[model samples]
Target: MKLAATAGGGLFLGFSWTGSLASALEVVSDTAIAAGEINFNSYLALSPDGIVTILSPNPELGQNIKTSFPMIVAEELDADWTKVKVVQAPLDTNKFERQVTGGSGAVPHSWERLRKAGATARHMLLEAAAKRWKVSAGTLRTENGFVLNPANGKKLSYGELATEASKVPVPENVKLKDPKDFKLIGTAVRNVDNHEMITGKPLYGLDFYKDGMLFAMIQRPTAFGLKLKSVDATAAKAMPGIVDVVTFKNNVAVVGKSTWQVSKARKALKVQYEAEAALESSADHDRIFKELLNSTDATVRRKDGDVEAAFKSAAKVIKSEYQCPFLSHSPMEPMNFFAHVRPDGVELVGPTQTPERARDQVAELLKIAPEKVTVQLTRLGGGFGRRLSADFALEAAELSSIIKAPVKVIWSREDDMTGGTYRPAVRYRFEAALDAKGNMIGYKLRGVGMNSGNPTREDNFPSGAVDNLLIDSVEHKSPITTGPWRAPITNFLAFAEQSFIDEVAHAAGKDPVQFRLELLDKAKKSPVGEIKYDIDRMRGVINLAAEKSGWGKKKGVAQGFSVYFSHRSYVAQVGEVELKDNKPVIKKIYAAADCGMVVNLSGANQQVRGGIVDGLGHAMYSNLTFKNGAPEQENFNSYRLIRMKEIPEVDVHFVHNGIDPTGLGEPALPPTGGAVANAIFKATGKRLRNQPFAEQEELKTV
Candidate 1:
């Protein structure tokens, strides 16, 4: 390693190396730039005086990728984790492409790229040291940020070689450490942001602050397709602290110096809207669902094995209907955004799942090039697919641009609950034909729900139609807007399908797990053509769950298990329940999942735990109703979230197969509903086919 003196008492270091040969490395830095805000995703440089720097990338979503991703690079580069500094990645797609993170794809996708960056730097420095000693590069090895010649017992620090390494060409195709040889990965690492998260550090969008920034809140129309006929902002403009009262399409926004003032003023504003023909209430939506069930105009999704003929020849037919209501994402932190529109460009910062989408939307809204609009993603309190949209960012940008000053748009609990996108209410009508031998001869499934964007090609099945399979969906045109709640629109449909299978099994006096195993066997042998799920993997998860849960063992309580394979992940869960004081008390849950190539076991378990808790909360207590074309639930006081007091003892076990990883977030959600629903049936002996079974008037356990 070599260091050269620079003009301002700074230092220059250099390293040079050749691919498959010896090399030298060089780097230079100034020590005057004192410690600044930490950005963990960028390069770290140091001077002869030993000052350090780093670059941080991606938003710090509650799921801790902030420390985790950087750890990957630090581990491979052999950098001192403690001494390393951090800074956020600026919105420069050219320099840092793919700043967005979601779909559980971050760890798996970035693992290699980050490792190579570190390994290449380390290799170059090692070559620099080897060349200085007149030794073969192959004989020198880098370890813990140090280049060492084992034979000569000499070592050079990465800092000492930093300058030299910069002068060396970065080696292409540097060797990566094998999993068995890894020191940091696969080990239990706590979240790097735990201190910040717990201590209430300003790390989220809601905490954003700007000079001369006004607070804004909007009053959206009550119903869908309701045209705003008029609005008088006179009273609001007179209110103390109110800065400006303006109207945007579909709503009026009240801007003030404080959030409370804006909220209060918005409520005081006089407004009128003209209701459209579709402004029918909750009862109307229910009626529409019923009509969909009877409608003959449905796109067939799948068919298999002369299903109609088999139904005709069967001795018994069974039918049932299940319904699910709309739901809000209800993240702990409500939607928020901070926007500053400068004449030259716009700077937008917020908690968003899709930063790329936000950048595009802001660019379009401001009529500026996408490059001119800077989108800064912050840590979301939670994002169960809700943050995927940039509506909040767009709204804030619009308000800020209108004001010609920096503004932070915040949604109160009420605004967030009623104004944002929702999961559409859906109904499922299921029917089955059974033979004398208790074999299913035919199955018919019909789903009705508000249109959720456009159903994919897989949604309308003719692609993999089974011989007698019949799948259809009737869409009820909706005025109430909706977005992807979790895993497409199939969340409710899969719940109905899995639960219906449980009902059929109970009628046949067969174990629920065994029933599913049989179906998987049938699907594998002569699969209802091109079934969406992996039969082998599905059966494997089911069998494993059954074995691990002691399926047939009696514990003086009823237990039911269900398996669902979706999003390329397989999940099986057995929920244990006991009737207490006429209420179902969930005792415990055993979950077995195989999301191939588990990257972070801790994060994987977190997803499952969160999913189970979410499912239980919705099944037992959550429901969103509508009255006169408006949502009935407003905030936590009305809509329920599973609390610590209600959570069951959850045991999550994963199959440690070294296969490619799959999604871990939403796959755990669908199966949990059916699993708990089945357990309720076992405890009560009353077939519970609908969601929110706890709310059923005639609900009973046996």
Candidate 2:
């Protein structure tokens, strides 16, 4: 990466694959700018008018990176926040090392690199001012886009020194501000694209439009593990605005001038799919998982101490089975992508969480070099790990190549719901051995799940927090596509482990929060193996959540507590609820999180709150059951989501820490299901082991 001067009198920061930095005097042509905007070092650019434009590399999935990334740059540049503008950078692997946005690593990975870019620019401005005043560079300080000399009362605007600053040497190393001195960070800053989002501006993939772009929709196989055998498109092809019908290995596509026409044509077309074997249903999966759980032959992921000996000598033993149904991402904006595949190259514009993967997939499909494919990212309505797959973008590229015209492929809500790549349903068997004193001495867990070859994550929560622990896993092969959803495996594991822990706490006659704290303290003092979690940090959030929620106080509402760690962040949540006619009426939820340094307080809070709601919705009524390997719920009606009326007031608090920022998008989600389940247990004295609590007949009578 190098910073140079452009012919348009603006600073240019260009990234080269050769890893060589250009000299300050090197002049680049104005054509290097993409869309007439100055190229910043892949991240930061300075215009002649002093307006600083920062390029955000990560995809914005409502996590507020559009504002947070620029805030980091402005903080280090000593630039006026008001004058800073944030632009979504197009996906270019040569320019950025990583453009994938899942796993909540956007801020943690880019914090140092972005800060360095801003600091380097600030240093150049200071050097330019010093040379003009014939004073030492150390004597000048930058304040709000200006070089300031306190003693002489001299100040120069960054715009005035922009040309001169472009000629100064880029500093090899620059100083970053201490957290204590931050002005914009840790403060509540408004989202940069709030206005565009509120006024219904075109910022999403589905909202993208191009002249002469044909709309396309696909009719996927009726069942999983099926192939497109035959299609009758005569009736559809004669319809108004219908262009052509194409067939792929897995599905049939309908291409037309408008989305409505394409959708109607797809529905009008008759399709036949061929399956190799009889489609397996959810009942079959449940039976297979149960058999796996009972079988002793399983892969051991973790073992500490003698679990058999501990269990044999135990005075009491508690065993339970937990099951969670498969779930759908169900993003508000259904999967859509615009692709223009020409002889020269392929251009793609869409809402994808993994743009680099999308670019590579398109290149591979088009039989062109990766560089020939350009992916432009738009604001995503929601991801939840579904956008991590590039299938949607690849479909658009394929359709465009076949039609020889720019095409936008859209998936209806039904298509998105029944389409493949769902969160794998899992079953967990847990056993705990307790001594005469009610102290747990041994723990054993056996997990059976689909899609993931390894059903259990050995280093998940409570792995290193306990002694005499044994973790085993069994995988069941299925044709249904499955992928990461929210916190991935932790989304279901946390609920299982935390709810079991709550049961153990009740058996030991201890408060749930206190019991967890004691276990954390034990782990901190005498950890059995490599303790992956920070015991101190975990205890901090747990204590904070208890304090904020008045944990033990009776507020006429049953309270449930859960704590979990994921993606390098620790979170504790408490759900308060009351039984209303045998149904859980959630009143409030309090959450405490320690995700290191908070970038934007408001954004962090919203992420935690949003994650909580998402988890609660899944635990409450969201489920995707399959019969004959076909999804039973085709839309929001059957596959229910938490509505606005059902949302409870969520109170979120962050533990003030000076550590470098981690990720907040996922950590807060894993514990919400467990907390709500525990609260329901307290209210009705019925332990809800299965997810989608509303569907359980046992819970309805309680």
Candidate 3:
């Protein structure tokens, strides 16, 4: 059955195609949004009592988009920021277009749309007052909450005219305030949700609860292709507080009154699984990648000049192979979800990147109308692409629908690590040719594993678009499943490519930052024939980072510099480090980014810093291993993350081009891995290629 239609006449949609309840869910539409009282006036509502309610459509995952997005609208509406109280918007895609938040596009893409919302509402308020007092609309101006007509000395607060203004038509082509006139856009504002976070409120999925809610835990097989054969419900059902032992598809779920009870029951339940080919191990991934490198079956992403002839005729040749291990997301809060299912409808609550997707998936699974499904989004402890999958939410929906009651399913830390949608492990083979003058003339990159494969069809990134780029992927083609991770395959490819460039710089006796800038300069000025990048802007970030980090000057120790651009954002990083007791120590980090017009400087800065720290953690101490097709890394004790003390001081600077904004969250990440590796090379003369550098041998500083 058709669910709801959006204001723009699009169907609100939901689904769980991956057989997990989460993958199938999403909010497709909400026509009521555009027709509602608050909808006609921008997303913010100011009452006579001086109370302000800010509608936050996207999930707040500690990125500060919650505060920043509203700030853009509030600035245009001339609303008092301090008087604002923010609430998470429901899964209403009709009202909140493109509500799926990821890729750092939240603020940059939504800035204009949200500002118009505010401006339209403000215009309506002024018009209402102008008509009431018989004055020109232009003469009736609004400030804070009051609308004043100076000509007649008549004034009315927004609260007094709220009902009347609701009847006024929403203005089209409403004038937006100039950026220069903004009182808060470029300024640093504290996160509106920070206080609730620090005080530990019930804002996250883990904190969600409902009366008579049961907790469920699923027992998965030991290997990817293994299937559940049989289970003895007797033992699990006998456990105190355990409700029932039900089998859904292949796995058995134990439901109980508490998470611990359910988990213990699931573990104790006697279960057996059919075994399939267990040959797909970590070592197998390495073998398949190597085969791809050795094969001639490659899809060309980009090509310019006769690169082959350039290499053969040139003076020098340099080659390198780099590898990166699969890694886990490891959000502080393990993946969890709350679901309530009844004969009439279903309710699902969780921290998710795609709320609308969750709604659709669950409805399809239950064979119910889309309107019967409701998804309540919670603040994510951390996403990094793991939450992008609705696996946990889907599982809860499925189990709750079967159990005919409200249920919350929580994956233990072990389950979270071993069960995570891992960032694909990768291998890169790079070859370059240089002239006698130490100028690079030719380059080729052959990527293996998933990097050679296609990204999700939904993302729309052309598969293999880099000039001289070759992608040759050999999927294991087994029953094993995987999904995208933070930066996904691109992150893996970036480390290898950027680090190899650093190696080339050292071989040619050139400054690393200067060497990259030259390439970017070439791409920008000349016609590359539809190359997917802004070369000049890329160089701008590199130069900005170099200047800010004192690239050529030795302040106290060694530093490494690197630059990379992706998802429409450009970033350059400088990592300051020192070698002590055979380990690399990061002293400081300087980051320069160009994502266009600055919306929230503070939030942008914070996102860059966080991405850097995340990349640093992956470089220093993160890896996901496998045993007989099952992940071996089961928890934080094994999969290390950067702690508070290990976090280096991060300084972020944004390069303003006075244009539209781009993504800021991810672009800053890929370069951090390469920059840190380059710096470690300086401190220890080691070119550490593979990840989890903590286990690599340390080089002595000369």
Candidate lDDT (C-alpha), each:
0.72, 0.86, 0.74
| Residue 460 in candidate 2, Cα distance off native in Å | 2.7
In candidate 1, where is summed lDDT lowest over 10 consecutive residues?
Answer: 16-25
Cα lDDT tens digits for candidate 2, 31-112? 5652223443667777666677788888999999888988888899899888887889887665666787889899999889
lDDT, candidate 2, equals 0.86
Assess the local accuracy of residue 193 in candidate 1 as a C-alpha lDDT between 0 and 100.
63
Best by lDDT: 2
Which residue pairs in candidate 2 collide? none
Q: Is candidate 2 or candidate 3 better by lDDT?
A: 2
Clashes (N, CA, C under 3 Å) per candidate: 52, 0, 27
- Compared with the true structure, what per-residue lDDT tens digits does model 3 show for residues 6-70? 12221223343222233243543436332122334436654434445667888878778788778
Against the true structure, candidate 1 has what lDDT? 0.72
Per-residue lDDT of 1-702 in model 1, one digit per residue for the tens? Answer: 122132223343322211111112233344542221111123444333222344446665655566666666766767666655444554556545566656655655666777776677667777777767889989988766678889979988765665555567766578977766666655566666677779999878999887788899988887666879999999999999999987887768899999988888988889998977567577887788888789989877655567789778877877899888888878878999988888767778888877878978988988887866766666778877788888989998998888898899998888788875888788888787777877676878777777654332242212222345576777777778788776656566556777888888877778778777766666666655566656667777787888887887967778988787667788889989998886777898889998775555576778788878877787677788877677889988988777899899998888766655665767787788788888877887676766676677547433
lDDT for 18 in candidate 3 is: 22
- Highest TM-score: which candidate? 2
